[model samples]
Target: MKFSKAEIDAVIAASPRTNLPLSKLVLSEERQVRPQGSTPKLSVAELAASIKDSGVLQNLIVVKGARGLYEVCAGGRRLEALTVLAQADDIPENYPVPVLIVPTDKALIASLAENVFHIPMHPADEYAAFARLIGAGKSVEDVAAAFGVTPLVVKRRMKLAAVSPRLMAQFREGQIGLDCLMVLASCDDHVRQEQVWNGMPSWNRRPAYLGQLLTQGEIESDTDPVARYVTLKAYEKAGGTLRRDLFSDDDKKAYLLDTALLESLATAKLQKKAQQIAAQGWKWVEVRARYVFEEFVKFGELRKTRRAPSGEEAAAIASLQSRLETLRARMDALQDHEGDDDNDDREFLKLDAEGEPLEAQLKALQESLCVWPPELMTQAGCVVFVGSKGTAEVKCGLVRPDDRNGVAEVARKASEVDGDGESLVSLPSAKTRPVHSEKLTRRLTAHRVAAVQAELTVRPDVALVALTAQLAHSIFRDDARGYHRPETVFAITAADCQSDLPTAAEDLQARILDVVTEAVDANAASPLAALKKADAANGAEQTVAATGWLPACLRTRREAGMATEETLQDAPERAASEALAA
Candidate 1:
């Protein structure tokens, strides 16, 4: 291990520097000791002249083998030169090239190390050497020091050695670079590593790009064999166009129009539209009124009417007659209550002023009913004729010839006066019928109930109350403007009333009154308006209470536990104190 230069020189001098005869040399057993560099072409004339003039300056390094044969380690070119000279009869045919005997393994290592120091070896040779060192149990540090590199570099070289033979062949053939191989080595997953290695186009594989590919899954991983195979096949079928159009402009458009994406957009749009419709219901009484009007139009046409109505119509007429009778009784009661004094007289006058319009309207209705013709009566059809006497009739089949003539005469008279009342006497087309209570009841089922409930859950305040009320008015009111049957309207009102005042009936009643008054002013249906106002009042109170500054008494009670009532009414407080003590 410590051989000096003199000792090495002495050994070299004693060792015969000659090539044994070709017949004696065991050519078949010769092993490649060192890889050859690219040989420069020399002309035969030049080679021959140089061989004759200078002979071979360097002796071939060989190890002694069996039967006096030699294995060439280095200086193969010099050996070849001598062989050529002998063939041309320029030198002795049996002449031998210089030979120095050493252990075969030592010669191989020395020759390789020497050549590696002087000139570059193929990557394959470097990888093999690293592998040999590792297999010999040499530490990475030892190998690094021997190769004049850091241990990291040694480790990288060792990794190259561990790479699959196929990949190594690629490296050796210069199909891939060391940088790319380093990338493959860094991969923790073997399958992923292999996939990345294989996926790389022969020209594009680079160490820097490998990190990106691994992080992004741009390159298929080898760890998941099945996934890797599937991905690889897909990639191949796609013509290996990776990373070329990954972030192209068209993908953004595709994402925008994707079915799931479009569905989400549509859902948002519908929700917004529904909210708008609900908000409109809250803002405009006319909208609800119009909806009710349309419903009534589907059932019956309004027309001026006279006497003889069916049993159902007669029942409705009787109800209206009773209401008018009650109004008359109230008016007579006001008359009798008058006093002799002047102030009392003035109060009576005010009462009379209010009663005049009521009396006129009732008297007019009475006269209209008294004069209404029986021939004008028919079943409910396009026109519902409500007699001023409170009877109802529908126009059945076609208009009678006499009734038609009468309507025409009325129209002609109204036209002569240029009166707008011409439309009132005209008969509507047949087919329309009064919307029956039973039909209205059938329409108000559990489906509507659920829809209203869902709406309240989203907006649980006055807005919901207003919306439900408007819906009630549409479904229940009796006038052509009121589509809802009375019963259905009552049911909805009850439910809403219950919702508004779940715990306090009196509070609910007050809120309803307030809402109705406000609604009446807003031109909304009285019942619905009342509910909306009640909800608004409650909401306002809640808003004020939530945001208002605390009163001093309440603040003191909270902060100091001082009850205001304790100091007031000391006699009662003393009694309470004595009771507690007792």
Candidate 2:
């Protein structure tokens, strides 16, 4: 490759620097107007907000225009932002805007050089810098303010920074995706992260699946039954840990890391309830953290009758009910607690204390109202268990099949006749399925998807290409070839790789392409290799072999992309050429 003397002359043209009022700077007429799906320009409002947050950190390149005015050749967004402030009177018309004044003839060169021949900062570097700032005693808010970003943005960077270095390397090498990295960052266990990655076949490593694998045993704090059963306060008191995702729009996006501890706390509460039930002359009381209706199918339940409390007990119950009503009124008046957790907790505790005696007395009276047959009681016992969401439930009068007696059978028959009519076991349905004829589609796709996902995860090399592609496409599509494109697809831009590359050492893209080529070249035993080999139409195509990672679907659409079309008067090069030559 060679550069013309004109380009060298443009390079050598020295640009002088100067400062001017914001109002005096204007957009350059010479600024190249690119079509959509080409170079993307920053919107005025967005640049204005950024400028308002952090004053211009870099200078715009400008050239002398008509009437002694300066036209911005580069940093058009910065110029536009300053113009907006000037229009709104947020800043004085004479407010200083840094500018690098270049020769009028060289203005286009300056703009071209700035827009082209440039690379974006690596995401890893950005994350590390943010982490460093926080590590240096700057609070997240402080760091956000310093960088002109939101606090949540700063936190996201911190999370990204927290990702395992090993995983991040895979990302740089196109082995994993940015979304996957983000999910992995949510879990701090590096060893666990790598293990999950390794366990996943190359086809199934999607961000969602990766998140599932990373957070498998963990529970969502908002939805976990245990979280609801034991108040967050109690769980925290018991040394359970919670992780919150600041990046998430939802305020309740907190996850419980210690599921074991949550179950332990729930068990302890159930154990106390079980102790009280044991005193009721039951043969045995089984306590479990959770209960499933199906597990008790073989255990027959006994019926119990309820009896009214004594006069004195009735009076006490009436008093407790009145107290509870008043408390409930106070709770309603508070209108959703509205950040008053302490008051809510205190009121709940008070209600619990007041209800305890009433509950016990009521239970005793209920037992007196009904009695199981003596013969049935002798053979059967009850199981005490915690229900979903952490409430204690009793399955009383359970008679094991082994303990069933002739008298118990008669009683069971009578109860069945009076019970709600529902089958104890489920039956299979004989309905036809949809046109789709498949099974475990999800599991099967994972193996095909993992490699693609890993390969297209974010990277610094094709960042601009991705950005340009995104902006060039409609707003409805993902920016350029990012996120949505199959990992095996390469949306290569010819405009890239145009640096002062006297050698490949300075060309990052060259080295990366080389790595990809070698890696795919060595994977001769890949799953798709056989399919590509059998494709007579494109089997000899380079793209099919180059993307050994891509499954058949992603590898080709029509003819192989790498196949060369027949061209010359082919001493039979093409069919037409062959006919003509003959």
Under the 3 Å rule for N, CA and C atoms, how many clashes does model 1 have?
23
User: Could you tell me which 10 consecutive residues in candidate 1 have the lowest summed lDDT?
Assistant: 282-291
lDDT (Cα, tens digit) per residue for candidate 2, span 319-417: 766766776676566556668577777877776676677667756644575665454555567787766755678877776665555435656554577
What lDDT would each prediction earn against the true structure? 0.46, 0.61
lDDT of 2 at 6: 74
Q: After superposition, how far is residue 273 of candidate 2 from its true place, in Å?
A: 8.0
Local accuracy of candidate 1 as per-residue lDDT tens digits, 457-569: 66545344455555654454345422222222211111221122122122233444343333343333243443464564454344333233221221111112332323222
The C-alpha local distance difference test score for the whole of candidate 2 amounts to 0.61
- Among these predictions, the greatest TM-score belongs to 2
| Runs in model 1 lying further than 4 Å from the true structure | 1-121, 200-204, 215-582
